[model samples]
Target chain A: MPYRPFDGQNCSIAGALAIIGERWSLLVMREVLLGRRRFQEIKRNTGIASNILADRLQTLVDHGVLERRRYSDQPEAYEYVPTRRGLDVNPVLIALMQWGDRHLAANGPPRVPVHTVCGHDAEPRLVCSHCSQPIKAEELRVRPGPGANEAQRAEPLLPAD
Target chain B: MPYRPFDGQNCSIAGALAIIGERWSLLVMREVLLGRRRFQEIKRNTGIASNILADRLQTLVDHGVLERRRYSDQPEAYEYVPTRRGLDVNPVLIALMQWGDRHLAANGPPRVPVHTVCGHDAEPRLVCSHCSQPIKAEELRVRPGPGANEAQRAEPLLPAD
Candidate 1:
């Protein structure tokens, strides 16, 4: 099937998904962010096939999320490094890790993120940027913003609670 | 191609991806969480073809992330609802939305999540649950936990900074 695009949606989640929503995309990012920059290393870590890995890496590079830099001239070797936009995907991966640990891990998390500055296990939680208060899943609602389409704007806004 | 499984990885993110990693899966969840529960509603809102939507919904239901309940008997209609496991995916979606808004959306966010308790836009940020301090992506590192396999445990640990 040809790639499905979420064009004209005006939704940020959709926009983000357009770039990194493929099944192997975020996993590739995880490998790179974990310091497996070489193709063989990323492939070994992710278990993605060579062709698919090549395609995803190209897509990430095309979208400006990753940059491929030459590491060896004679061997023509390259390493994939995260660009600023690529680094921005860290929160998304962290959130997924937390959810997976809480809901799916039977033996406990396979890995845990640690806050280097504080030298403590970083159990990341979402807090409201405006009030700096913790935000729970059920304690939030949504409203149309500047980019909402006509139909979305007409939909009734309701409190999640 | 047949569905690819991330088996024997022993990673929570990989575990979660094995369940909800398909391109349309999370978008389907977004529709349901936004209160579009009925089949026609979710279909119209997401623009997902019937077969693919059916597959994604069934996958979610099988994984215990969503529950299908009868809402009508005469026509034998059903509605998909988020279970506790499903609701836990909110943080993942929220993190993606924040990333999209910051980096993808050009006209501003199409919708903004509001903290019902504070009655203001949530603008969620990640903070360390241990130290209760905001966490930067660069200021974190990962170490093997209780579930790590021998290979993963053998990998070198490096500070994210």
Candidate 2:
């Protein structure tokens, strides 16, 4: 499929989606983040065709989310490792997993995130960085920021409902 | 493109992606979550084709993420409203937005999320719900949960790196 870039949107979500929004792209990142860094391992876990996986990995590398490093000298083998930008995607992955566990998982979540700090199963929650209060969808509002273009600024900023 | 369902993965992330993993689906959700409920408004903002927008909205409604309600009587105008499931997608959207703001936004965040509770520009962070410590990608681990099948359980759970 041809990639569609959200060039004019001027929204950060759209900007991020332009990079990692594809279905397979995020799944590939899931594998890398889970420590399955080799080509075959990610391919095995995702069941993605080799060509497609290669393409996704290249795009991720081009975007600086993952980096390739030689792991085996004799075989010329390389491993894909997450950069800081890639590791930052953890929250998005966790958010999606929690959503699935709540709505789609009939039996239960097949995988659970463990917070090594407190030694317990981690239920990650989105909280305000300044106030430390849990963020609710209705309580959040949007406004034009420094990066907002003229078109974006003209749009209604407050929650309409 | 044909939608490829990640059957047999038995992973919540994959399950979630099977629904909203499509590139346009999440963008559509971003629009709805931002209070752009009407068809024309969404189309205008996302620049998505009308047919594709219609298809995505129908899929979201079918999945219980959104509902159609009559907003006008004479012209039979209707609006899309987020259900609980839809509202739950806010975190994912916020996470994506923050990622873009950090990495892609050249100027700054095009839009800022305001925490209504504290009346400050909200920088949402994912923290352990139990300990309230901020989550770091390197400090987290995954394990097979109650819903894990034998295959998932057999895969190495620890972070290899």
Candidate 3:
């Protein structure tokens, strides 16, 4: 019954949605994140139409999520690479995978993430930035910040910290 | 020129494409992430069609990214909350914002994130699980485990930790 495109008013999440929240956009990102930098490789994997893929690539390039680099001068070939802005999208893709694996998998995780550094399988644990303590939803509090709206008077949205 | 979605062939990202990689879904997630729990608020904020909002919410609930909770018994009022699975999707949303704030914003970040534990602004930093060192794309090494398909070769996707 709801449309949840973004959370807070005028927040980064909202701003992001305004640009790349369309269908096929993140699919393109998934390919770049997965190392499919070449146009042909990404096209082969996703099965997206050529025209649509071209548009999505241009959009991502426009959004700074991908950069188009000339791969071959003979054919004027190009490959799309994630910039810092693009590479940062990995966590989001990982988070989405965690959701899909949990709810959608027929077997177990259709895919698994290996924390290359952990020396073992790794699960991301959210920790408090200041205290360095592991944080959970109940353990955290939310309050109106500099961006709070005039109508948002409901007990700071979360319990006081 | 290429239809990149099918080429890289990592299932988690692929599965993410089957669900949320479509248009309007992430923006919907944005609203949910921002704390709008009702159908009306989501639709209002996102300007999505009532039918489309209904469909997206159903898809999310069906996928377990969000759960429908009864707010009242009489009318069977419900609100959506992230299961542990749903909250896990935050990183993707964050990544999208990082892209948006950097490329889309004319000024600076339209919104900011705060580390609830320390009571100040904090950004999510990816760290190497092995050394607990903050990780950048260049520092990590990943080899596919049992999950690697024919599509995923030894080639590292994105920059390694």
Candidate 4:
């Protein structure tokens, strides 16, 4: 498939999607984040074709999300490790997992996130940084910021309440 | 392209992706979330082909993420509105936006989320529900839950520290 870029949108979500929006990219990230870094281990977990996985991993490395490091000298084996940027994808994964757990999971969540700091199952919540209050979709709106173009700066993006 | 289902993964993230993992799906959700529900408006903003947009919207409606309603009588204009399931996608979008803002945005964030409740610019942060402390990717681990399959139950998914 030809690469279709979202560069014209001038929106950050679009920007991020342009990088990680492929169907298998996040699943590959999931494997690495779960500590399955070797080529075979990620392949075993995701059932993704080896060629596709190699392409995705190369893209991730090019994007600075994952760093490839030699792990074995004799076999010339390497492990893919998450850089800071890759680790930052945790929230996105957790948000998706929670959404699935609520609407799709029939039995229960297959995996639970445990916060090592609090020593309990982590139900991650999105909160406002300024007020430290939980944010709800209805209670949020968007305003043009420093990067806004003329059309965006002219009006708030969301509907008036 | 044939529909690829992630059902065999037994993972909630994969389940969620199976629904919205299409390249254009989340961008469509972004349009509706930002109050651009009209077909022309969405097409203008996202540069998505009309047929593709129609298909993505229908898929979202079929999945109960969006509710399509007639908004005009003479021309038979319709609009897409977010259902509870769709509204729940806000977190994923926000997480993606923040990631893009931090990594891709050269100037700054094009759109800034504002918390209507606190009347402040909302920098959304993911925090543990129990401890209410911010979550860093390194400080979290995953364990098998009630929905875990036999393989998942056999061991922890993430590496041990």
Q: Which candidate number would show the highest lDDT if scored against the true structure?
A: 4
Better of 1 and 3 by lDDT: 1
lDDT of 1 by residue, A1-161 (tens): 13665767778887888898776889998888887789998888888899989999999999999999998999889999988888888888888888889888898888989887788888888898888888888776688888778887998566242
User: Which CAPRI category fits model 1?
Assistant: medium
Worst 10 residues of 2 chain A by lDDT: A1-10
Worst 10 residues of 1 chain B by lDDT: B152-161
* Model 4 Cα lDDT, one tens digit per residue, B27-127: 99888888899999999989988998999999999999999999999999999999989988888898889889998999988999988899999898879
**Candidate 2 lDDT (Cα, whole model)?**
0.86
- Relative to the unseen true structure, what is the C-alpha lDDT of residue A145 in candidate 1, on a scale of 0 to 100? 80
TM-scores of chain A across the candidates, in order, are 0.92, 0.92, 0.79, 0.93
Best-first order by TM-score:
4, 2, 1, 3
Candidate 4 or 2, higher lDDT: 4
Model 2: CA > 4 A from native? none
Error of 4 at B124 (Å): 1.2
Q: Tell me how far the alpha carbon of residue A121 in candidate 3 is from the true structure, in angstroms, after superposition.
A: 6.9
Candidate 2, residues A1-161, lDDT tens digits: the string is 34475877888998888898888998998999898999999998899999999999999999999999999999889999999999888788988898899999999889999898897888887788789898886677788898888987887467655
Clash pairs (backbone) in predicted model 4: none
The model with the greater lDDT, 1 or 2, is 2
Model 1, span B1-161: residue lDDT tens: 13656878888888888887676888887887787888888888778889988888998999898999998999999999999888888788887888888888778888889887888887888899898989887776788888877987897576242
